[model samples]
Target: MRTSIATVCLSGTLEEKMRACAAAGFDGIEIFEQDLIVSPHSPEEIRGLAAELDLSLDLFQPFRDFEGVTEELLLENLYRAEAKFALMNRLGIDTMLVCSNVATATVDDDDVAASQLRRMGEVAAGYGIRLAYEALAWGKYVNDFEHAQRIVDLADHPNVGTCLDSFHILSRGADPAGIEKIPAEKIFFVQLADAPELSLDVLSWSRHYRVFPGEGAFDLTGFMTHLVRSGYNGPVSLEVFNDVFRQTAEERTAVDAMRSLIWLEERTSVALADHGGAPGNDGGFPAYPMELATLPAVAQPTGFNFAEVKAGDSGAVEELLFQLGLHCEGRHRTKPVQLWSAGGARVIINQQQARGLAPAVSALGLDVQDPLAAASRAVQLKAQPVSRRSQADEAVLQAVSAPDSTEIFLCEATGDGTVAWAEEFGSDGVVEGEPLITHIDHINLSQPWQHFDEAVLFYESTLSLVPRASQEVPSPMGLVRSQVMCSSDGAVRLALNIAPMGLEQPHGGADYPQHVAFACRDVVALARQARQRGLDFLPVPANYYEDLQARFRLGDDMLDVLQSLNLLYDRDEDGEFLHFYTATVGNVFFEVVERRARYDGYGAPNAPVRLASQYQRARSGRRDG
Candidate 1:
């Protein structure tokens, strides 16, 4: 099916929107009336420009409030629509979308609406144009698509048919199964949009909160499945009304829109095939008849490559690493960088003079099946590619920058992946790895509020990771939204936490919290070893240990061991998790965790206690001053 987008969905001038849509590989465009009214280009010039861009002018919209009115008002609306029909001819657009009346409707009779719409259709037909009547969810009289369908059926003109918008149907909680009941020929055009389930006025929600498919809570896979099964194979166009998209870069937003359509089409096809019978039939469904290209199947990530830390004050960061029991393997042969290792976990400390002293996590290295294929998929999903200069023998890694400006490096999954880069490090002798730490358990990244949803969609669509239902945890300051994305095998786990709106910190300070948790075979022994290295564990209140004993009814020996080590413990039905945190090193921190008996959580119940402890420590230092 052809892909198209509405001009209102993007920012910039009409010409800019056209260029962006064409560059993003859209087949056509729905020319919104407001976009044309505000443009400098005449209708003929717009038509010529679209032709040069190889884009079809799919539809001209919208002719509104043209039905269900008094006789005089109805005649006035018809005359107004006739003017638009003439404009569509000049713009070389055959189809016009006339939305059901939202206001100024005096008549409630279907016959009255049918008569008015039929007159408008006649006017459109005289100009060799078509009319697609849509039911807006907030329409005064005809809010349901079924009601609008009845009016169109009554009008019964060749140029008159129904326009189906997924948002209109789904936002009202209307069953989309009725779409299959409508004849394929009567389905003149389809508009697609996805939205979060928000409790607000329908008009407000539709205008301010609509997102692209796969980015929100809507069931777009099922929605598109209904459309495909109905044999309504027109351009599957996006008509988003998002405040963020309007302010974002037009080119970027356009690319993101196209990616959503591609992902939606493939998912719809898969859903149809899974049904296992005749297409659109209630029984086992067959493959969808529409043709769409499928992306390469993403292989689950096996492990992490390396976690990179960049600090203007590299010495402080290096000291913290030593306290965490990571040995400094060696310095890079050419760059001012040091490599730290503990069993399977590796950290690169970059102290280039050009970088600032504010401590931050600059990059994440992912171990994947095919680094090139992963990067290709990211490109297809509109992630920005990043390149770095390297020497002749240096290993090349695929990298991209996420929306939050975090860099991700893709490296080979197994066998000599990081070892190949050892030639760049100066050390010749083998560096002994730490015995306690096994691998990276998980990485937690704090995101700004505005970019949270975009980040979620990026990880899901690009890396093929699944997102768990988001949870809001109460924090000392406000509620923090935490979303986890992980692979099927639990190899790559990322926790994306978002600060509540208006609480975003300035860049370069403690703008966001970032932490790397290292898996350990034995937390008790590792904590003892780490303490011997002069590690200052984040203090846990004495009351916490007392409560832990009371809550779990642990024996005296276990409670004594946990208290002595400053460890936090949590138990669920499946298993237990024992973990401890190091004092904050600028905005970054470190964690050592041991998961027992299929424990998958990150000890969320302990977060408030941790935050309070950190706060107390800061307050103590200020009082000492």
Candidate 2:
């Protein structure tokens, strides 16, 4: 696929944006007119720079409100378009994007609009240029793409055709199946963007909330499938107008944009394969004029092998784990790391090269069917390879770095659920007791505000994990936005959270806590044993029990036991959930959960109370200090 992006999608000077795009491997870019108007370099100079960087100047956009006007206004618009045509000639671009008349359209007659477009097309043809007319979602009379296409057909000029914009079409709930009816040659250009389903006005939503594909709620795979079936082989470009993308680092945003296109191409390819890769009566899936390339296929991770924490002083973390019934199995022979385990759940405490950093959940080990293949696929999708030191005697794990700089190790899945690297730890023997925790239920990772969406696409594309709809949880500071990504069988779950506005800390300090939750058969029994071991539970407020009783109408005995143990309880149509949290040790904490009868939630209803309790405890600790 020929990938392109618009200059308006990034944050930088025009020159910087071009450089970032070229570095990110985009084949071409559509120059937004405002970017050119503000550039110190002339059109010819910009053309030279694009050539020097080995990039193509695909199109110059956004000539707007040129048609559906009176005679005198039509003449004036023609004069204005002629000037842009000369400039496009100078810039070495052959096409211009003319959006449907959103303003200054005195006449709503199709013949008038077509006549004006034909006149403009004559001017464009004189300059050896084409016009890709597009419909705006909020256009005065030409809001629908079909309406714009009808106008293009009436004009019957070789220089005039339609520009298919995914945002413009899908945002209006327009059916894309009609695209196949418009001959492929008349489809001059295509622009792609995905957005979450929002109830706001279309203009507001398109202008500010557009996200990269796979990061939003849009079904872009189906959109691309329809576009490909239309046999339009033009450059598939991105034209997003997002407030967040405009403020982030241009290089990072450009890379994220490229990754989105790569993912979209792969998804579209799979969709085609599912249709038997042949044209049929069902949909007539003809041979694609444009070939879509795919990546190395990988299955979703089977489960989490271990969660690793790094800290300067491991005493607090060690004691906390010990109190939770996880004993230190053994220390690594060559590294300052110890493995703590109880049943299938494992935690790694690494004290190596952690001189000044706060304790944090820094890495995760995932069990994949084939680690090498997974790593290869991740690298092809622009993930940075993470190198860890290991000797010949040690197991060499393939790994990659997530957008948040967390190292993700792709460990080989074992038949008996044993980790190969665990043998490297010189353990005397297994500890004697019934296992308190069975395995890891989930891990919550806090993301930086700017990279939250980027992290979502990263996990979805690289790991093949599916993202659930996001929700907001109220905290003491503000609202916390949380999204969950998990495998199909519910074996691996990652809860990604954007901290409430005022709670984010620089360098990921203890100010914002992240926790690892373990699944236990009986959380009440585990909580009782932890209390006897002097574990400091995150205290629950007295009012929480009263509210719980009111909500669930539990008997007195049940509520009393829950309150005495500082445990939280929740129930749904499926089953019940019992869980409790431990006090924060630096930035890392622990949770023990018992899920009954296929209850597959994270107890989201109790999140507000937990946040309030943690905030109150932190404030009280400050006063005591």
Candidate 3:
């Protein structure tokens, strides 16, 4: 399978887009006409440059509004298509994409459309080119792929064939199973794109909101499976027009585009293998069997091995950890780092060695069944491997850099990295009491506006984590979008947060506060103990308890107990949740949570209260860590 991407999906000049695409290992490219028209390089020069970079100029696109037109307008359209055909010949490209008419169509008959397309195909043949007719979701007459294929059949010309676009077909609820009925030779090309499920105008949605394959809600695996089962093995290309991709860095956008395609291929192959073939539909797709390359299975994260925080001044951070029932176990053998452990939760504090590096989460360690297999899967999904200096005696943990610039260390579940490294801390394991805080419940990660979707796809593809639908969170400042990703067996959890569009730096250069939530059997006991240690908890307002009383209808005894302990309360159809927070420790904080009766949520209804308290602290002249 040859991989291809359109030039319009990236940001930069045509030359820069080409260089990024080639560097990302794409084998072919679809040159949008506007990109060519605005280029400083001539047609021949661009052609030579593509050859030098080992890329095939697969398709020159988008000859639009040519079919289903008046006879006089048909003549005018033919004359216009001739000029584009000449340009394609000069650029050493053979295929041109002809979209169904969205405007200027006085005739709406399929016979009229077919006759016009046949004439266009004859003219294209004169220039040694082929016409791949595509149906726009909002086309006046041919708005469906079946209708487009019918017209292609009526045309009965050698050079006129139909193009299949996943967005156009899937967005309008068109059935893709009919693709297997069409002959392979007539399926000229395929353009793949995915979009979120939205209620909007089709034209505007296709032009502005199209995302790469794994980033959206489309069933691309089913779509691609049907197409490949039909015996069409041409270049699978991407034609996305996203507002975010057009403004981001060209190299990053190109790499993301390529990664999405790679992920799609692997996912579709796995789906095929699992189902034992295509869904049976009258020799529909089961006729053609697909064999795809396989990689190691992805291992779900077992538990958090450790959470590392880096700061210039480590004294205050250590005091805060100690206050939360975590005692310093020991120091690293070769580095200036200390380990703090509770019941099963571990925290690492590393003194900053690099100047200007803010105090924040720099790395995370996750326990997995097979560390090497997990690393191999990550590499196949296009995650960048991170290299860290290590002594010969220390275990070399497999690591990768996430899109948020945090190193993800994968350690063996049973031994070695987590247990063996404890000896290097240079202390025997002895601590106070079976601590109230037991294990990590979840971690909240803040993402920039542009990197949010990419980060979602990265976590979903690289770690086999499942993404829940995004929800709007009300904040004192504005609405924040939050999405949760977790393992199936309820072991690993991540909450990804993205600020409103105009407020990327929502807190005036304040880093998005990263908080670690620990699970506890008795959160009240943990809160009382923390208060005794002189921990400054984020103060919740009195009005919050009143609202909670009305929402849950709890007795006065339970309500007074919650208010006294400074705990937030929430309840769903399933169960109840009680959680409390600590003050910000250099843009990092801690939360102790007790989940009852299978409560799965993170108490999102109480977020406004927390935000209000944090803002109040900032207004009271508190400094950011």
Candidate 4:
């Protein structure tokens, strides 16, 4: 859909930004004026480079505060704009983004603004350039897009039109339905950005906290739907001003920007299809001038098949699993891996490639309706495909690498909940016991600071998982930003956490802890059995139990059992959640949870206590060592 990005959205030199954009398959780029002013290459040289890279220099921006001024300032602004127009001609760019007068606007009269804009338009037309006038959210008098459009109409110049920016419109809570009323031809350019809902000033929010579409709280799908309905066929470009994006690698940020656009396009198409753009006909909607490509549609994963942990020495992990009531169902015939199961929950212990690395979650196996199609969609979204070694008799699972370098294996879902690959783990027979754990409830993965947002977009776009609003949980290290991504159903929950600042290593390879939680029918019973088996439970402080009693007013018997078992308890309007954690084995740990009467939360209210306990345990361990 003619994707484009602004040079201001990425890190590195202008040349590096252009190269990264081209490599990421953007059709064009809007050159931010500051990037040009700082470039060693002249405008002509930059134009040549864009041609050599087969990239279009779509627009030069941003000419600001040009209208709504006095006669003397108007003449001075015109002189300044004329110089930019000549430069645009040299750079082979036909359009310039003129932001609404945020500063130096002595006159707030519409006629004065329109007259000044018309005069500037005449100067731009002389150089064969168009002006895409945009409203700034913090503009002095021209903050609203409708206000800017009215001025554009009054100007009555062919070279002047409106540049609709999603951030400007949506951030101000302006209704985008007005866009359809404006003539499509007058919609000269469009810039897209998504941001979290914040209570801060609009300028501060737009300048620093803008995130890629699907990674933030904005209703961009609705925004894009309205834009598409408006029939504006201009390049849908991203113009994000994020502190994080500006510091990340240009290549990585460019790819992330392109992925966001691709996801936005797919989502917009689906929204349009839902709103009367059905198959076999355009279904009462006007044909879109810009074609939006749909990806291979995939359903959300049904459930987690297995969670794989890699450890150099698997003894501690093996013993911990045994204490938790999971038995070694079988060992891989030709690999240094073993499969442990308790009912439908499975954990794979793989030591084949662990080397001397600490224990960590290396891969996740998800049950999907169509593994091949799911893998195909993930690969199309720029996920690197992972090819695992398998013999002819072994099942060949479709796999891809997540942004955090975790392997995601898309396994075929079975009606009977049996995996064919499990057959490869040949052994005598299933262990005999009343299964304590029923299945994998949820998994928590730690993400690097830089890749946290990228990982969110990756899972949302590639796996069709929807992200819940993020929350910050206090830990001994710092505040941990945690967001949950899950299927529409209660199944398949993934909790992604931005590790507390100092705990993570570079490139997300920190020894930051992660855990796999298993669902049990009765967590109290499970905790009792685990204690009998000598499991080292992560101790809950006495103060936590006192607070729990004060909050819930539970009876003495229930509270005593919970405190004795070191179990954490929480209750919502829906039901109760009781869970307990195992002591950490390297960077990995386990959790057993009992969800009562449709309780769907992850016990988020108790996260701070758990984090404090784990931190205390680690510190004590260090002291003992």
Instruction: State how far residue 446 of model 2 sits from its true place (Å).
Output: 0.7
Q: Each candidate: what lDDT?
A: 0.84, 0.91, 0.85, 0.90
How many residue pairs clash in all the candidates, one count each? Answer: 5, 0, 1, 0
Model 1 residue 287 distance off true place after TM-score fit, in angstroms: 7.7
Give the number of the best model, judged by TM-score: 2
Q: What lDDT, from 0 to 1, does candidate 2 have?
A: 0.91
lDDT of 2 by residue, 504-603 (tens): 4321353467899999989989999999999999889999999999999999999999999999999999999999998877788899999999798989
Runs in model 1 lying further than 4 Å from the true structure? 275-289, 352-354, 415-419, 426-434, 501-510, 542-550, 554-565, 612-625
RMSD of each: 3.7, 2.4, 2.7, 2.2
Query: Taking the tens digit of each residue's C-alpha lDDT, what string does model 1 give over 1-625?
Result: 7999999999999999999999999999999999999998999999999999999999888888888899888878877888888888899999999899988898999998998888888888899988999999999999989999999999999999999999999999999988888988888899999998789999999999999988888888888778877877787889999998998789878977888888887677667766763343445445445565566667767777789887877776787778777778889877888888778898888787635566768888888888898898888767889987777777888999987778888888766545567457765356565478888899988886656777888888888888988887765566878999998888889999986553333222446558899999999999998889888888888899889988999889989888888999999999999999987766778899999999999898898787667656654662110
Candidates 1 and 3 compared: the better one by TM-score is 3
Model 1 TM-score?
A: 0.90
Sort by TM-score, best first: what order? 2, 4, 3, 1
Between prediction 2 and prediction 3, which has the larger lDDT?
2
lDDT of 2 at 442: 97
Minimum summed lDDT over a 10-residue window in model 4 is located at 502-511
Query: Which residue pairs of candidate 3 clash?
Result: 586-625
Estimate TM-scores for all models: 0.90, 0.96, 0.96, 0.96
Per-residue lDDT tens digits for candidate 4, residues 512-598, read 788999999889988999999999998899999999999999999999999999999999899999999998887888999999997
The worst-scoring run of ten residues by lDDT in candidate 1 lies at: 501-510
- TM-score of predicted model 3? 0.96
